[model samples]
Target: MIVHFQDKTVDEQSRTSDLPIHIRSIKDFRKQKDYESSLSDRKKSKLDINKKKLKNNSSAKINKKIHKVQVYNKASDANFLFAVLETIDFNSHRPSNNYRYPQCVFRFATIIAIIAGRYAYEFLRMNLRFLLPTIQTIENNWSYQPYKEANFRFEETQTYLSSNNCQYVFVSEDCSAIIPRIEYDASLDIFNGFVTPVVEGLPTENAFRCTTIQQLKNLFETNAYANLVNIHVAQPIADSNNALVLPTTVLAAYGTDHKLTAIDILKRWLIIYKKFYSRGIRVLGFSTDGDPKFLRAMRLAANFFVRTQILNIYNNTLAFKVKIPSNWMSWFFLGSTQLFLFVQDGVHLCTKLRNRMLSKSAELTMGSYEISMEHLHDLIRSTNKLDHNLSISDLNVKDKQNFASCQKISDDKVLNLLLLNDKYRGTYNYLLILNLLITAYTEKAIALSDRIYCASIVLFYVRLWRIWLHIERSPRKNTLSEKSKNKKKDQSPHFITSNALLCIELNAHYLIYVYLLIEQNVLPQSIAESTYLFSSQPCENIFRNARALSGVYSTRINFTIMQFLKRLNKLNALTELKHFEETNTEQKIVFPVHHKIKRFMDKKQSNNNNTKLTSFNTHDLEKIILHAYEIAQNMANFVDLSNSLIKNNMFNIEQSSKIAKQLLHLNCLTESEIVDVDGSTDDEESSDDEDLDTYNKELADIMCDGDFSEDELNTSNSFENLQGTTYSGVSE
Candidate 1:
């Protein structure tokens, strides 16, 4: 609306001759100028801001967009490239004519970067102290402390023993078979105290000192008893490089010596007893095997220690004072003092019994009647040699033949055969009856019921044997001359004849003593109680252990003792841990396989056979008897030939008249050969020869004509029980 015009065209025409000038609105023109000015100012401000930003970051390198890129490679390849490039660069910088420029510099740069990184790591490690300790520092700083020595001196050991309430100490001496030559030989005298609490199953825990003669003397002289009041005497002896290993301490070993004497051994025993007695330990007994020297020593020692005293009589009807019976009055034990019993070892006694049974020279009423043991010995030897364990039925015909041919069998096997064979039925019954009594006395104290049963069996067998012997002999007396018959009719002949019979009779007396003792409700006062300790087996066990540890040819006893103690200590520790673990967890029961069973399994596997044999629980005696009975029953037809021998005052009769007919073989006896009840069989009635021949033929057929199976021929299970009887119940 507000417009203005300028006269530019007329002035331009006059001054410039034909220049055309156009007129414009002033508002529109002003707007156009302002817009242009505003645009120019904006451009200038943007340039100023970008310049300021560039100036602040002037130290940073330019970020150029690189299109040309170097090829990447492995370190090994890069190293090879760097070596090649450096060689080229070196040649290029050299003054020689053959110098050349490198085509690529990337590998050289990479090698430089690697060197820079290694240098950086080295610098960091050398400057840092709180990073890690050196190996030397660690090794020197941490280590186990040095072990200190044990505080168990001689005095401490003595004090420990004296303070404990030790009672019932037994002394045992045995020569260990370690390096058994003169100077290298060694003996040990172990002092073991009875276990506390006196439980039946608990083993002896009071392991005391094992001392030599000289050490024992030292202990006695030094008042090792701690000045106690009780007085008893004991001395232990050792010679020929003997060493003593006690639980807490090792005594000075005895040096090499010659042979040891009984007197020296006795003296050592006295000293040991005195020391133990002073320490409040009642020295109850000394046990040893029937070694000749030991026996002599014991006799001499007993005589020396024997004392006599008069005991006041009690429970007698006489008033004031009753006279002591002469039988009751003895050289020892007439006063407060008691004499230690010197009884033969039970195992030794049993061995002697076996020897007596086998000896032809043994004095007996039967006139040197000996039981042969060749078959038993051969059977044992053969059985041992078999690769597989054989069951009773598993034994082949060859094995049976071998066993039957043996002539020197063991006593138990002989007894077992006697029991099974109908020919020796009388002897079998007698042995069984006596064996039960022996078992009751040897193993454990019998109950009242068992004692009554045992007594009944014994009495029954005795009465039966006596009556049989009397009736059998009575027939001969009826046929005797009238004058002789009249003289002997009232007198009963003593029929029990064998040495075994006498021994059994003596054992019966001991059994009766045991029964009376039980009835009186008294504890066993005898030296050989109804316990395994009746044998010197415990001492023997220690000797076996020592010998095994020392080896057969060891000479240094001290070294042996040290080695033995170290092993014992380790074993004890392991035992303790095992006991602890077992108590905490449930116990696992494991039944041991019997030897026969093992053999049976081996035979079955080796032969690759599934045939079942007649099995038995051999642990049970009843099963053993049944098994043996089966074999006997199978072959009993031939037993009738085992006719009983008759006596007609055989010692006084003529040699032809004294011909005794007994079972000498497995062949049957003929009816025609049977003797009359009277002595003169020629005048008596006789059986038909044809009938006797027929009977003999039948027996022969029964013996020879048989298709015997493996089970029928097998005697392994039948005789196995006998092998266990001799030593199984003796002692460990």
Candidate 2:
């Protein structure tokens, strides 16, 4: 147990999503070194080891204790009692002809089971006949949210949001790559894969159905849709279950091209903002995977200038200690509501930085130290990869980036051998920057001071590294300022990519804004008291799980858009469960483990370490920040940042205005991106934990209303080649 002091007290409340809850394969779990190292030659099945430890009286006296069993009123308890009572007499243990099951049990079981496969679900039902509900009952009660291209069920969604008390939400829009193929939806009776048309910004609902051969021919003549742009809304509810922020999929659409321009994006964002605002729901932010177009929209949307005035209260501190860039356009407002923040996916940013390090054309350096794969290679070569977690395979450049390699390379613990020596100090500094950003984006909540300190250090070094970027005819020194570089080669040369720079700037500014929000008195208690919430990870995670839920096709990873529509709720269920694991620390979210499955008795739970907010020292890094500031300050004089990261030739004259304007009469607004904090309080229900049972019931309810639509996920021919039809197994 860890004891807390006054300065270093640890609160039991959950930190953040604390997610990245990896559901590893059995082989991967078994391969963990800790699992292998813990076992001796003598160690066999755990049954033997457990038997030695059990008291002889525990199971031997079961018969005598059977009658003493006190059955509780709960269904779980009643089922346990029934199982105990039947042990002694099989004939006497007859169940009623129509035994009613608690919907809660079916809610817990059936939805998740069916997604795995129809056959596996049947096998479980056959084994536990009395414990489960029949598939027919489930089929009659449940239904999938029908496939409507570009449909956002506004009223139904509002009812759901109101019921669940998700008032403040962050909207994340990203395109998940799918197998580009035309598919028939059995329910909608329409052919998809023809790119949905986007007018202004909104994707027109039920458009371009290939009912005739000519339309089908046209689709064949052109490239079929490759990616589904999913606009999802996420609420910050870390465990406690009461504040359940299950991602509501607003729209899943695809278009003629894989890109959306800033104007196109801004229009759609405005439409969504208006819809949520009209319903009394306050949107707090928007997040995406650092897409250039989306970043431009984010810059226009940010209301940082309005909040910048609040910094005058700390004027004595600023320019006194460090120069904080205050004009960060990373958040904005809609209607009379609050200033909405912008979040670029943290995972993507880290990957970009690593990829830049790996790029042949760029150099990453700080002072006398240069960070490259060569240093890592030297360490690996010296030990011949002896006891090394990182391999040469991790260093390869690929379009499909591997985050596991990023984690390992960024790990100070894994590279502690190199860190101890001064010769590899540049490597240590580079990893330090990587680690800080990872923590800011992915880890538990950190202190206001700590977050800023981390952001400042990370941002500073990134700028310093850019100054050292390799130029064709120049020495590897601090001389090639932005002015010295050719204007024509604006995007061609130098290390820092546009997205990376914006993210670095925005992330640093966000850290500073965390404190600003608290001071401005505009933040909800939940937002003010938490770690970073604006990440596109949830959107990414749901898509990853979409492939996982696609049973037989999982091996091939063929997730069509139709398949995604079918498993949408299941993906959300996985998200909810992930949240439960991260926050509900006392009672584990349980899944059935069969007796045949091997259990790791000694595997360390490294994930648990991430849930708690970290407290650390932030002293004595002034010289580094100063040097970084000097180079950045010099470069800023000539660099035109608006070329890539910001919008030009337009003011915030028309933002979030693509839809029919209604809420707050926002049509009359000017400088629309900037906001006033004098808006009405969020019409959010108090997150009373007393009704948390309703939370479980709601999840069950959300899942219960459906079965797979015919041809919904049919990767192969129909198995019922005889649904004409069968009862259990025998054909009728």
Provide the lDDT at 21 for model 1.
Answer: 41
TM-score of 2: 0.62
Candidate 1 overall Cα lDDT vs. reference?
0.30
Over 1-732, each residue of candidate 1 has an lDDT whose tens digit, in order, gives 123224565565466543334333454567899999998899989989988888755624332212111221222333434445345446546654443323122212212212222233235424532221222232232221111111112222233234322234345444333221111112223321111111121112222233477854554454221111111112122111111111111211121121445544454444444444433444444556556555545544333222211111221221111222233222111122123334334444344333433344432111112123333343444554242222332222233322211222222554565554344443343334435544433333333234334533443233233333433445654533332324333223333322223233323333333333333333222312222233344455433333333222334432222233232222222222222222222222122456864574465344334423222121332233234333322222122211222232222112211121110011111111111111111111235222110101111112210010110110110111121111100001
Candidate 2 Cα deviation (angstroms), residue 466: 4.0
Best by lDDT: 2
Over all chains combined, what TM-score does candidate 1 have? 0.32
Top-scoring candidate (TM-score): 2
- State the weakest 10-residue window (summed lDDT) of model 1: 705-714
- What is the lDDT, from 0 to 100, of the residue 137 in candidate 2? 61
Q: 487 in model 1: Cα distance from truth in Å?
A: 39
> Candidate 2, which ten residues in sequence have the lowest lDDT sum?
723-732
